[model samples]
Target: MIFGSERQQHKILRKNHQMEEGSSHEITSPLLSNKEEELEDEKNEEDVVEIDENENSPIKQVALTVPTTDDPSLPVLTFRMWVLGTLSCVLLSFLNQFFWYRTEPLTITAISAQIAVVPLGQLMAAKITTRTFFRGTRWEFTLNPGPFNVKEHVLITIFANSGAGTVYAIHVVTAVKVFYQKHISFFVSLLVIFTTQVLGFGWAGIFRRYLVEPAAMWWPANLVQVSLFRALHEKEKRTKGSLTRSQFFVVAFLCSFAYYVFPGYLFQMLTSLSWICWIFPHNVLAQQLGSGLYGLGIGAVGLDWSAISSYLGSPLASPWFATANVAAGFVFVMYVLTPLCYWLNVYDAKTFPIFSDDLFKSNGQIYNITEIIDSNFHLDYAAYERQGKLHLSTFFAMTYGVGFAALTATIVHVGLFHGREIWEQSKSSFKEKTMDIHTKLMSRYKQVPEWWFVCILIATIAITIFTCEYYNDQLQLPWWGVLLACGIAIFFTLPIGIITAITNQTPGLNIITEYIIGYIYPGYPVANMCFKVYGYISMTQAITFLQDFKLGHYMKIPPRTMFMAQVVGTFIAGFVYLGTAWWLMETIPDICKDTSSVWTCPSDTVFYDASVIWGLIGPRRIFGDLGTYSKVNWFFLGGAIAPFLVYVAAKAFPQQEWIRLINMPVLIGATGMMPPATTVNYTSWIIAGFFSGFVVYRYRPEWWQRHNYVLSGALDAGLAFMGVLLYLCLGLEDVSINWWGNDLDGCPLAHCPTKKGFAVEGCPIFT
Candidate 1:
């Protein structure tokens, strides 16, 4: 609402300035020149955004104000603009969903929204909405508490609703339900998303002063936000030239309705294009040749890996760095550990070395691999089932082991390494000076706070408990377990996240977490569920923090407002995300014989939140007879820990210089650990980081310092709009090319692999 209202205020200001300035240009020139000269003199005397310890900090005088009834009409949109922006976001959201949904039956996955595309549409809409409706009327938009304001609601909703990151969240919940034939109610899903999921936002705020502000830390995604704000507000400042604002309420209503219906039907027509499929498929050629585009595809496919990748590349870097650490994980799990069992000839690798679902059977029936290994080696399948997925006790032991070593190593390195810059930033003068630019920015926009997020968390938790009790009382675990999972996840994940954020990388954590869940909950769903919840919450929070931090990079909203906006966004999103998630789960069953179809089901093991739960917590429950000494755990653990080692290595020998070269921990981890076949993640990372880094580091200019976010904003906006069209045209139908695998014949777009052994197919969208 603040965003929308701001547009209106900006319009009035511009109109008044234009009218008055136009009438007296000749007479006012001398006076204006004198004033300009005086301001120039002041700039020389003191930096525009600089701090002065001798005087009260420039920001101290500025106070936050709320909207009052005096300008009630002024604060609201004229109905049209509000409708248009809202409609645009909704259309984009739905289109994103249709494009990514796989139409195949017999595939045990559900069709869910393309999480990434929604954000792009929102990003695009942020600019379009602001520019089209609020350009000169920023002040007219109210920041006061009241019923929904179009501007704020649109921005927050877009921020909240857009992005495939939610898929990971849904996947977790879906996996658990599918595994046990249990469903999480909409309320439970909301509880999981809003409460525990957003706690990381608070933690992110705690570190905001350090990551953002003077450090000028770059979070590219926020550039989109900053761009939108500046573009809309620039007219008031007279930094850019002129356009009338769109009729607010008119466009808003239209766009919202258009968004809702277009994706429902129109997407079927758009997805028939050939170019999309030629560029993004699952084959090796597509994987290798189009990997760069694959990352772009993420944007179009409605998977917001860019945000996550950006976060990992800089501020919240764990998962990305996990890419680098994955190599070590592979070495330890596959090469070092699994081989030990094979050396003893426990099981015949020559016959069945590569892992398969039925390792001990010739066909579907069981066999005697265990018998042969009994005399020389032993594996406890019974013990495996009893323990279920990796348990918490195991996670605790490993985390302690890893954290103990990492913390000691990191502290020593920090003392020896970045101690000076840290010291400099701590100085009152420096802090004050740095805080000044942001202080001036505070008067520019609406403010939200940390407490709002806290409240949202509480409310979400309450809702989840109520939902769980109502839907599946028998499957419920103690609330403490959930809380404990969140607590441990938050503590353990922060440093890793921070490291990744700075380095623009992430060390893998999924495997380790899975193994841990297997150890703690054992045979119950409790451990698995907790692990999934914690994993999604931790990662999403870290990413969101980075996003907010990036927003701060350009604008000067107090840490409080940024936090509050996030809460507002999250609270709003929680219900929408859950409602859609439940709708898909509930509605998809009747359309296709295979409820697991990626297009029809809401719970695909690969893409759903439940995947993590299943892999980490339910795998052992379902397939525990698999050996822990197998190469999987060893390699997986190695990948998870690589970044810690890299960090230590970087700190210990600053001169070695290779450390700086290898900043992309996630990239390295991916290349090193994931079988080379899985290069999609790395390729995507490289492509994304390349453009972002180029824009921020090489292209940044000294002038227009306050408005540097425009480029990024424009790019994201353009891409998002294009992405909407992409999904609309080709995303809704079962029309992808078949190469490696396919769905059942009767099912839409379903085909079995032709035995060419899984590779990318070009004609997926067109065929």
Candidate 2:
């Protein structure tokens, strides 16, 4: 799936050796070359051969980007590193968790901190004293460890990466406290956050042989950071009439910072410019076709970078083939399948808005979720029966079905495509003779004992079982449920890790995990939420840890230092994430409930909706034979068959190279974030991806190779800085600028039901 046979590997090695002898700094693969005829072959060959002769990585990108040597003398765990790394981790954790509740929830990645920490690290190196605490003792340490080095920079970035995203277990805490209106102890919440975050360390340790040490399992996304690191650390020779990478990044960052004020606060309509809705403002059918936020956005586009990269992530970092696959899936689901189902009024679709994440009554009203819950936090079947069956918007329901398809498709797709390669890799992992340059170089350092991970795994599981069993009244999950969740996480980690390693796309287990526990142990929403986090997020955390390990491997940071950095960072991030969320929940009045303010909590809304659907109400009544939409279950079969067909087609048309690129899981799961991600997000993301990944990359490859990833990181940094500034300076004081330009969606009628006599307040009733 990733690399071919031993013969092919030898061939690639020979080709790479030839490439390493050239005179240029650019890296290109014949397999990935586009428009080769337009370029001079001599120049291209020279560019390809610029790799270091000592570099033994089989992946061309790694050979070109990562340095082949390491300086073991560089200090990584210095006092300066600890101070700066801890600050970066804690600050990002607070900022990200704080922003998670906003309407356009901006996730500022570790790239920002990676860039910001450079100057601070250097500043600390320059200013701090080099005085040792204990002159000749074993406990002696210096405050300044000479000049700040790249290894320290890598560790700091790793620390920031730990806190870049909000803790997943917080969703359960927020759902119970804010949405479900129940009390959960702070101590109990802390355990959930800490354990869920650290439980993956064990999985990462167990699988690092196959996932991290191998040269073939090259994680594509890490290349962006690798490129950024080189740009920041290595000296560059500037060409005449062209800016250096850092210069371009600075310019882009300033421009992005200045421009975001319009879309972020002053003129919010630029975030989603639905001009089609403007042309036919009063026509419901037209609005339904064109509304960027609430319907199938036909010609809508977002001018805001946040709107584009917020949900789907930066398109600039993703490969064109992967972007193409996602675009194909988005089009099929959003344009074709969704519209067809709605127009046909499948499952009373016309009674509700075509695109909404909110749970609803059958008659198109918001469901009274609180009414069905008893005082003890369990579902009251009598109250549920009296209130009638719960309903979901047609789009939301279909998205769940698609999620089901994605889970099965991922399993089938990986088995059909990557099974043999994975088996071979697994077998080879045990053979010390097969070690690559990176792994061999790493062997010089003291290896982290496997017992370290084992102890953490055992302690976390014990604490989890104790917490759930002891606090059974609040948590509702049994000790056995905790074990089951861990089993599911352990089972799926390797398969999902393989897909992520090669393709840069990870199929989530959120739906499958929830569905399982909901069927086996239904009614307690807390139990279901807890189960999903352990089963799903733990696997995700493992992949994240492994990804960091690969970055460390490429950067030549010692394995022991990486382990310490990640473990410490995870603990710090977990505490800060929970603390910030708890503070926000207590301080803000009607936080997620408010429709007028920016604190809408779009993601948490979806999380709460899921808790109600799969936990409070249970999946048996929603997706099983007892449900109104039982036929949607056919998607699981469809998902499994589609991948098999793709595999068969690839075998049949061996010469048709394009056939292999039709990734069924990516296509089917394209709109996985639909409830929180709207049409504008996908449309804007695709356009940006095409321009950068296709046009610039194909035509001006040298420029694309250097500036593309830097530009992505710069844009994210600029937008994040401006967004936080806007909120603090203006948003906090409730500053006013009420005008037509501030109307974000401009499609009030998009959410209105088209069915005659289906009355909804604030919408025109058609009789």
Candidate 3:
């Protein structure tokens, strides 16, 4: 297949300049002068050659960030790599799963492990003996072949990336056991986790040529890691007034570590500084507008880096153009649409809290989900009818509509903007002439055999079918459901992968998968959850695997080695994730409940709510003919049409290059994380994005290039380390200081309804 083809075709013109008349070494001058001049000229020539080679690629970001050269001699799969890489994977997996049940889940990215392993790798290289084993044999190896190098570091980071985030399948297990309070065997859960995690490897292998090798599919997020790798490894001279990159990283890391104590533990109010709520503490309307944790958060902002980057991600890594699109979308949704709808009482919005993800009755009381679930774990039709139609908070319903729009927008956007290019790429994928420099360099290493992926794909599918069918009483999903889920995952992997490859934003399949299976098999919550995991998370895992492959490609690591590392790391992470989660569930009392905020599983709560609404209750009762919010389905058409309009506008106004950059998918999907992500998250994320992406990148290009990504990595590493320390030292013991400063959400009235005569406790009833 054609690997690494560029979208934009640009030529770099070369110019050869003759040496100036007096600048050439003079015979009369000292021989030392001539030698110095000669060396300087050689260095200048080398710089020009490097620039020209890099510029040959059409994508500007790739040309700027990735290095043009490669060192094949550097050992990648060394003894140190296995030791450090495996350890990093296991530790990160355990830590991430451990933190996933918290009030604000801290996702410790691979960047932290990337930074932490450098010292350990070097220490091993320094201390271990270099004596070779099995001398004169083809299988000879040594404890330390050489000093720690960048290649080994990249592989370890990839290994860590495999386990950086909590395993998606674990959510299924949590939803079934803790939320549903059902008895599920650990073997079934393990099978589900391993199968779901590995199932995506098939999709990744099939689409690697399109997603990983394309020069135009730059995968912008990888640039941050690439920049960090260069900063940590490349030697640099400290400028006259500025600190060296390493020195700056150290200073930033320490400051970030020290500052997290306020928002993380001691003064938790710093996480969401809703000063407006503080001024009018008793005013429901005022608190609703000002609260950062709930409501619209009109005037809210955060001081905590975790609150900013938790859901939205580090804004420093996003490109200026993409960030601007996301900012516009957030404002349109949170500021304009939400306020207008809630005040107008769209879908009886004011009957419930202005912003909530919880299911409710018509009178604003929380829905009793257990009442509608029968002994068979199916929907009790009589109980559901007695409870009447379920209702959602206005913001929650609107978010679903937006999700519908975003999914279609993604497909339409790709078809309109990238259709022709994709078609052409498919037609000429096998042509070797289309390969870019990175691809050419990678070609030297033996390519992974297609049969390996085929074997994995077949085996994973077989195991999944066996698990579902053999354990049908517990799983409730039939063998056919597994095949259908795989089909959906494989079908969307290409389009979704393209969007993620280009934009750093991934449009999720959670809603679509849940809706499809909910309609197809309505009564079983576990079945719907399992279907969503297999269909949605498999695609997610594929995209993640492709992202790592792109990182490996940029670092010039061998494909086979990359494959091996990912497979091993994924298996290790799956076991660790399951173990940690099981331990926490067993040890913690009242976990995933209101009694303990520290272990109140936010994401899992949302997942369980979804199971009730879509599975136990079924969409036919909520969004179908019998549902009150049926009109929201019109968003599908709106989403489809929105991108076409953008496409027409870009064509009609070709001179306005900015029109082409208006991404509808990103714009519509911008608020996808809203229920879980509050106002402070988006507001703080936007501010950081604007300052770093636009301000620094526009006015101070040199400084932005030198320090921006390094700063991002440092902040992440510091927060991760400090968060773990706090949890271990204080959180586990429930040793918290109770005071105003420790109050995370200062707006007590934010969750209260403003509707007339609501009669809810803790709020003044409107008369």
Candidate 4:
């Protein structure tokens, strides 16, 4: 052995002693403290290389993203395919729209069809044959051409997917009748809803080459479906002492199915348990800070996987790098900043509850929105001023501030990072310069040319114009505004579509459109919504369509077949949703009114409230330079600047690849998911994120890759199954189970924040 000199040996020993001391300190420190956790997180992050985007990362375990480029030979558009797909489409359409009017609307995923339709499809495939069932002079037809293959399954799923998204325009019509006490003829309502809901498809078809064909444009969310399909169809061979994919999937699905029961039902308290709230049960501050259901969950923990996975998506899906930035911002804003601002009475926040999305009066009562609006659906400024400005929770206000920031951040981040690539790709794709495996395979099939999309786009625009012309008094929209809305949607489609394709999120143009319409058509509430919906939802719908297009491309389904399924599915969805909306309105008395026995149309109420706030009252009265919350407007500029700062840092320290970890859009986008999620969701989301993306990926690499998405799918399926069962068997039947034991997850202390003796109505919550 080579021995160093005495001096060199002393230097080595000293270095060892210093490392031992640092290790001791880190291990000895309490992990429960927020400061300690923050430090630990920073250190842990420094050790990680790439997240889900890096294929080598254990977090992205699915080795096979897209299966081999074989011929997609099986039938894609058989007679049975349309029949089954349309039936499933109508069923989902009916159920989704049926639930949209509920206090807490239940949304079922298309995973139901993904799993359930396999057997029925196979059965039909086995029984039916290509032996001419129907014969015409020109053509002979069959119910089945071959076994129900992946193409058939994919097409069926596509049919069911059309009704997956909530029809936003129905809310507008429902709000007019149920909340605002105004009436629209059924024909006009159906036309408005149908046009707005499906108009984006035209734009989606137009941008397919730019957004759908590229290999790098991986929509991470879509991979779950791809994985599921591969598992069901692509047979896997296993060696001795190894678990086959099927065996692993079965075990995972069963485990998730069993575990979800506790958090999902029966002992619901397990869903959210704040030790702080338990320790200081009587302390209002603790409850305000810790409870999950009512307050911002500062020190709360939830056991429900579904609740944890809300809004942000499965922890298995988000990369740790993005997760870290979001958690950092979420904790800083929700836990630290919001509390300081509320305690110090920023924006007179101390006058209202510390946490709520609802608007409040000076006396801490719910704002009487009807009293402030005129018969024409525009704001009565004189009445509003007399009633005083509407107030929001400190957290809610911050969400808006962050929403504005996120909006601009999305724009700037994409432009800075992907703009050049997009430009280069644009030139190539248009000239037919680039082709990947999926695109090449797709080329063998006859393409749906650009003119098909153009014709549909022109026709829809014509219909929209005709509707506006005929219902000018009701719609309050000029022909120019209609054109302008579609133009804005078309202009932003390519950029947002590209972003969605890569990030699995579309940076919405909702705020931008609302701001534009508020300024341009300030007094016309209906026109403002029309403009906002056309500008925003159209783009969103376009993204959804393009996402499906890419999914079909990856699966090797024919473009023309996809075109048929989507068009037919969309029409069915529109009809079904319209019928459901009309049926519920007519059947239920005072349909949108708050009722303990039935759904009160919470989604519609929110839609109505937003319309009143943005369309009727306008942004100038809320977020302008002279508005009550004028300080928040600065976030717009701040949002734009944040990405530039990150860019500069990346440029300066180019070797510190970890510098890419600072994602402004992800951070800001996460903070703004207000309606569907609250503080509890984000806190639990971060906890799950670190576990899935860090600990499991690093230590349990095999399980991480094999069962992560499978487990997520199982959990989602289980929760959906349970939710529907409970709703049908208990909720609709009004099976009363009233007791302290049956109280909502959080009670008494939660939602009861003490601020100068709090009151929501005439009574003080503290008392």
Candidate 5:
């Protein structure tokens, strides 16, 4: 008011006129040209954000990150508590492992059940941790425990970290030991996994900005983490009191208990949908039609790892790119690789149209169905022994091809697309917005440098050298072979992880790793298995961790806090995993025989140790199988080169814009090329795509974006909760009562015997 004097009034009037002119210019500018068009688009996007009402407040989002320095307090000894928590996680690991180990053994797919339960654990942990412990500690201002409010950091850590690591640990041990087969010291297996985590985590610290950011490096697995974090920590609407978290806890805990006692498996109800024929009109045609229709419904909703025909649920999962990467990877593998392999006579159509198991008999075919099955039609021992080594040429070629494409893409994409942001944080950049937040936060913190990765490489080299010397009298690996293995693992890790993070599965690496072992170790399984698992799994964990970090980024949880939580979780998980692995191996001997056992260690176990021990270390007579390395599948390996070139060309020129539009060509290729049964899984993808696209794209308001994730988490939790209930009450197999009706085989197995036990070879029930 005092400034309302003549001189002040004149100044205010001039300021108003300037503001009016600026506003007019801004309003009219977008009508001008190309630059203005982009500006208009951006403005429209902002407008869309403004219009959304139900979305969470935009101010609460955070960047994904990892620990740069070890937290002094992270190691605080609740030694007894930590020990018990680790044991609990390990027990959980045993349950998760019990599902798949009976069949595939030593494969990455071992993590599937854990993947399902992860959201449940994360949701519960977030609720309990934020609600109680955080409030008690007064860190609640930032931690914002969502709903459950248990107020115990150690308890939360036990659940979230244990879920992933426990399964991973079991996988690591089974994979490493069985592959080696020579009875490795238990401590050694633990050491390998622990070392991999430490080193991989260190390596991940370098690219925290690239992964955690919104630059659209899709890691949908992290979405739940981000959502939960935001719900709790946001300054406004402080989600500390939400019922959702409590609901998630109630659901997850009840499910966990039910899972402990359930008879069938994690996928029990899923297979049941196929039996809906009993409820339909009773004619044979009607029954067949009814089953098919029910199958379609189940496939659309299926979440287990069965064929596409029976896909009734989804993982409530995704690869960072939604289904696009799945499509692309599938195309490359199915259409390009499968057809090429077949054409080259590397894959005999009669014996194996899909993957070859008996690499020895089927020429260059990578998998053989007859060989894969045991006498009981589960997994065959004779076949495993016959095909212990892979064709070197086939594996290396694929590895080199993927390596070339991934490295090139990584460099070009990072430099051309993200370089400025990396160096100067420039604008006019087109990337996932989250990437920007990741970059900004990293810049603010002191990060682990690229040099650290170099150090890791060096340290790994040193360990390899020492290992070679120790086992040298047995398996003498060449320095070049070691480098090749390391290179393949690191390079392939990015694409495989990216592909899986987006697509859910990428079988490409299985071939690549297999062949590489054949080339280096030949008939020996020991060294081959070790190298492949360390390389592949380490890379895998790195990407998965990155995806997890991205989730934390979105929720505005302090990067440091997330890092601490992960470390605590990882350590707990490691110990727990070890115990579970030991127990499962001891208790389930029939399931984990070296050959043809249903839970025969991890898949890569034989491959790794066989390569290193027999081929590399063992004398010719001592390990007669060593000579097999010379039988490289040259043409198969060569085949991958073309795709590598194609990918590079696309990156360099990108002439066919429409090509990019067909993002998940591989997914279609997979659906088409795999057995017709796989169609069910393909169907599930369409369903997931519809839901995710609808929630994230069609509904683009801030509120929609913020809350939809929570909703998705809720749905997953609810279904999982129901699954628990069905398992508890109805039972499965012959373990308990069958309340839902008596069939154990939900959907019939691939070659299951008839109800009268005459049609097929073995039992229908899996592990």
Candidate 6:
């Protein structure tokens, strides 16, 4: 078995209006729970999770749960564990990177590992019994070491999750060659990807004391995965009146698998239905409001469960209080706020498409940045002067301002709310008995050294500096600019990590790095991208790595062993993701343009546009005094204060329990998630959320416990199973069955735009 591995995966979040778009990969981080009774009181704050909700009780737990791993002695670093983890890592990495270039940019989570590793492990266990397979030879060893246990399963998941998506740097790598026509060496791309990812390990390794060691820093998402593992491996007597978890999981899995065929392949229109679009096919306003796939959904609904759950999360796992917060914020912002502004023609938005992030000329045509960008990828002042300024849709402009507010609000919110606690936790790291039982158990094992991460950070930094400095055509970044990028990541990691560790949401560094670096490294588009990948991706990678660290701690895997697996796995994934991107680029024709083709680089277009705005033209040129949308900059101040006021309100009016649930970061942060996603997603997600969190948890407690997370795993598995089957059977033949029978799920007019006279370039492309 290999002792060390590096893992890297990619997930691109979509940005609309000012930001890029939502996530490139839908992160299936599973939900909240704990076994400690004293921690039940910790549920008072929804933002702060301390325990899992009681399984037998009728309510959802406000805090994250801490469950004990059943077995600690089982050898986690074994022949079978190594083989399975590595294989799954490579395959999923390939799969995600392949889909990453598509117009829709669909990708699955390492939750697939949770589903696949088990059955495969069980099969291997059955075939490789201790006495039979390696019976006579001293050289032979049994791959099956006792019943396949929780630790092995968990280590496998960590490996998969680490390598699940393309490393964030791939977007920068892809855009340089594909969008900017800059050539890059294989080594340069690989080194950049590896450095952007591994550099974060230093921060994660250091912060483990604060984020992973504390009992209160429960990673709420891991609880769902924990519950599923228990349901599968642990034996419990079946109640006479209730369906067993296995039984419910089986039923839900098959049903979901069968239903997916319709919306996923056969009847695509089943994804969304907009009666308004059908009734008023030629009306641009009706199209804008009712086109489920193309516009904001007005009186729209989706039949596909995946589409419903895509934006938020699985309804079964999300607690109602959290769900309600997401729902209320999504609605009030997207439906009420966005529509009102657009109708009022805010920003003279009526002249442009209702929703888009693509820069456009003031005259309502897609703003061609090539005209403004010179051959060296620098902004041409004369060309820019001639073109005037770009125009953003009303909703798009609104999101930018809101995004500014969200960034500052998160910093202020964390400082006011969790600053004192973080300081104390740092103190508690050296003090005995201050840590949780999980931490105590983990402390017994040999830990990975801070020096290892330090070595990684120093090495990757050297490689990156060389890449940026020597390869100016591709990177356009100075050596000091590299340092500044890293500095931004280091500065934000603690606060952002604190936030995600408590509440699963991460207020990303993407918007800020682009905004700030745009100002500093003005006119150097590639430098802006380099800054973003290093600053934003590095921090996110650190936090995610910390999440896995906490996971290994919970499962009681040796820290050193876990570290080795990730180091090896991430390195392999870097190769795999790069290869897949290269393959797609080489094969796909008319990519990033022909949306009708699967290869259209919808997400990368956002990436290109962002570089043009923040990197090429610079923020000073766009949002500064010379810009048309200068008022949006005031949001920095507004965001900084909003969270402070929210905290004061919660503290001042202590009686208003509802005020405590109003997480300012999440509410404002959601505005940024809009675009490239429709109102139907919000509608469907909220519906599922209320059903599971409110109805099922409240009305049928027993049912919720036996099946919630288990069912989620099964549904994911079933959908995947069917997808594989369909693709192999028909997709390999390059046959996508297209028909008008169930077109847009009975809403042909759904894409009709309501407004007339003005040509909204790219208006055809809905959110």
lDDT of 3 by residue, 12-90 (tens): 1111111111112111211123454344344322111212343344676666567655656578889999999999999
Measured by lDDT, the strongest candidate is 2
- C-alpha displacement of 215 in model 2, angstroms? 2.8
| RMSD versus native structure for model 5 | 13.0
Q: What TM-scores do the predictions have?
A: 0.55, 0.92, 0.93, 0.87, 0.58, 0.87
Clashes per candidate, residues 3 or more apart or on different chains:
139, 1, 2, 0, 100, 54
Count steric clashes of candidate 2: 1
* Quality of model 5 by C-alpha lDDT: 0.40
Rank the candidate models, highest lDDT first: 2, 3, 4, 6, 5, 1
How far is 678's C-alpha from truth in model 5 (Å)? Answer: 5.5
In the predicted model 3, the residue pairs found to clash are 2-429, 4-213
After TM-score superposition, what is the CA distance of residue 3 in candidate 2 from its true location, in Å? 32
lDDT of 2 by residue, 1-767 (tens): 13333334333544554465342433222221244223322231211111234547786656655655444546788887898899999999999999999888888889889988989988988899988899899988889867778888999999999999679999999998999888899999999998899999988888887798878788877888887876777554566787767788889989999999999888999999999889998888889889999999999999999999887778887777878999999998998888899989999899899999988888889999999999989889999898888887878988998998988888899899888977887776666546667776577688788899989999999999999999888789999999999999998898889777866778888999899999999888999999999999989999999999999998889899999999999999999999999999999999999998778999999998898889988999888876777888889999999999999999999999988888888889988888899999999999999998789988987677678878888888899899889989998898969898988899989998888886898777777
Off by over 4 Å in 2: 1-58, 433-436
**Of models 1 and 4, which has the larger lDDT?**
4
Compared with the true structure, what per-residue lDDT tens digits does model 6 show for residues 57-141?
Answer: 1212312223432233366876668888998889888887876776544456677777788888877766774663556888666
Q: C-alpha displacement of 174 in model 1, angstroms?
A: 2.4
- State the displacement of the C-alpha of residue 483, model 1, in Å, after optimal TM-score superposition: 2.7
Predicted model with the maximum TM-score: 3
lDDT: worst 10-residue window of model 3: 8-17
Q: Evaluate model 3: give its lDDT.
A: 0.84
**lDDT scores for all predictions?**
0.37, 0.85, 0.84, 0.71, 0.40, 0.71
Q: For model 1, what is the alpha-carbon lDDT of residue 529?
A: 54
Q: Assess candidate 1 and give its lDDT.
A: 0.37
